[model samples]
Target: MKSAILAVVLAMPPQAILAEDVPTTVAHPRPVISEIVTADPARARRFPGVIEGENVATLGFLTGGRLASVPVEAGDQVMQGDTLATLDQVTLQQDLASARAALETVQAKATLAAQQFARAETLRARGVASDAMLDNARANRDAIAAKVKNARASLTRAEDAAQYSTLTAPTEGIVLSVLAEPGATVSAGSAVIKLAAPTGREAVIDVPEAFAALLPPDAVFSLRRDKNDTAATTARLSVIEPVAETSLGTRRLRLALDNPPKDYRIGSLVEASYATVSAPLMTLPRVAIAIAEGPNGPGVWRIEGADRRAHFIAVTLGNTIGDRVVIRDGIAVGDEIVTRGAHALTENQNVGDRLE
Candidate 1:
């Protein structure tokens, strides 16, 4: 019975069977599409940074001696004239006392010599003392007087040295580090502490020379605690180191923050974001591009009309930025291109959204 039914259907008109075998092709909706336009014209670059001071000063003692006491430590706040450290005062006091004692002895000898010279002068006037003896008395008195003058000058310097034995802060600031401790001997002019002025806070960043070359003198900056945080604030470019660091191939950039957060102190970690200036160019989604086996423009399958038919259009590509590539030519704004399944498309093929 089945063979008989099949034979009856095949005996029908040949035109009816041919028409039922071939189905008509229909234009379908596009799933993924991209419009040609200027995309992300400004390129933003980020660098890690830290808060720093413009005027950081390293302090040391003027007179070398064994440190007897250190009143301030790291992270301590200090004011002008505040004592930072003190050298052993016993040796200083003894030196001062010796200078004073020496001065007293010279003064006593000078007094005795003057009195002897006076007696000799009186005797010489009465013709009782020899001329040679009188001359010797005068020379001793003058020499002792010169000795007294020398002793007085030595005493003055001893007093000054005693004063310099105590190290004091020159200005109000926060101490960053203390290199010397009590009982340690340090030489004069050797750094004992590091201090930074609390006036201007700035961000220091090491940027690659390639990126630094494109940055303008007046480039703008924004600093944030982290990359994902939106609580960022603005900063201004203050200086760029002229010489590149040969070892790192980078240059240091100093940016001033007019209104930084209260918690943003010296050495605070931050991220600096800034934009690079470049000429505007046309671009398309990276997914819309596909490699073809030809020499000329690796054509893109462009979608057109309400029918959503795919057409292969050749184009010239430039640089690639993030998820998009620059379209130098052969495409204009408002043109839709197939972003998904471009590899499976052909010229004038009916393409549409695939139902999941």
Candidate 2:
């Protein structure tokens, strides 16, 4: 019975291997690690701009004359209908006076002709004056009446000329420049002053034609004094120049500011940026992107928190801005990504933390 038992035991499968007796190998590698930086998908990029008035007006005289007075200068604010400048009224006044005298003379002649016609009519009725005499008196009266009407029209024109000698502001605005000095002779309709409306302040920026074409139709914007300034004001894309500037290869964009800061003034330099974010995205260092694809798609070598091993995680990529790329998916915030030497890493490989 003992021999039979021994034979059964010897034929039995070798005793089960002990786990403690087995040896395992572990790998440790030092790799660059970058903490995920959470931010708005649409990052603001600044472009230079200038603050200016939306409506810029060039004011001048309706008629030619020497400028006797110019009451406003650059930076002076004026209301609508305020006198801006005036021409020497001496010539206009003299012309008006002469017209008035001419009118008076024509009126006297008409009065005398009317009296003579009345006398002629009575004499003809009494059979003393001939029909020829009545006819001549009537002709003289009609001729004088026509002269009086012409004289009255001349007087009215003279009065208008005198009134036009003074130039007034068409609207409330600030004077931007004084093109003509006092006592300077200017031609009719020549620009004398440059005025800008108080309202309608806008930020003027030059955008490359290519860049402008890429912008969305409803893209929003904001303005700031500088890149470091935290304060921002809303802005609307008001107008875009139909034609591009050949020399600069850029198009003019006018952005109307909303509730702008008090320091914003005409000619002030500003920075403008897009306010709308198309999508929420995660940003990662450009070096972290691997050329190879994973089972899902484009991926990164993500380090495991507990194991300190690199694992390939598929990700959807987006636009790259500078040295960073927009991550559309797969990686969560706070995930440690291999920024450098990611191309050399393999799936589930041990990694060392190196933060820079």
Residue pairs of candidate 1 with colliding backbone atoms = 29-352, 29-353
Q: Please, what are the lDDT tens digits per residue for candidate 2 over residues 42-70? A: 34556899999889999888877778899
TM-score: model 1 vs. ground truth:
0.54
1-356 in candidate 1: lDDT tens per residue?
Answer: 99999999988999888788999896565455445454333336678999987788998888677788988887788999998888888977888899999999999999999999999999999999999999999999999999999999989877876899988889998888898888998877998889888877899999876556555578778899886777887888889989899999899999989789887888889998884335434577778887777775466777777777788888888666567677778766567777778888776776664334
Clashing pairs in 2: 29-352
Consecutive 10-residue window with the lowest summed lDDT within model 2: 36-45
lDDT against the true structure, per candidate, is: 0.81, 0.82
TM-score of each: 0.54, 0.51
Question: Ten consecutive residues with minimal summed lDDT in candidate 1?
Answer: 34-43
Superposition error at 330 for model 1 (Å):
20
All candidates: CA RMSD in angstroms? 12.7, 12.8
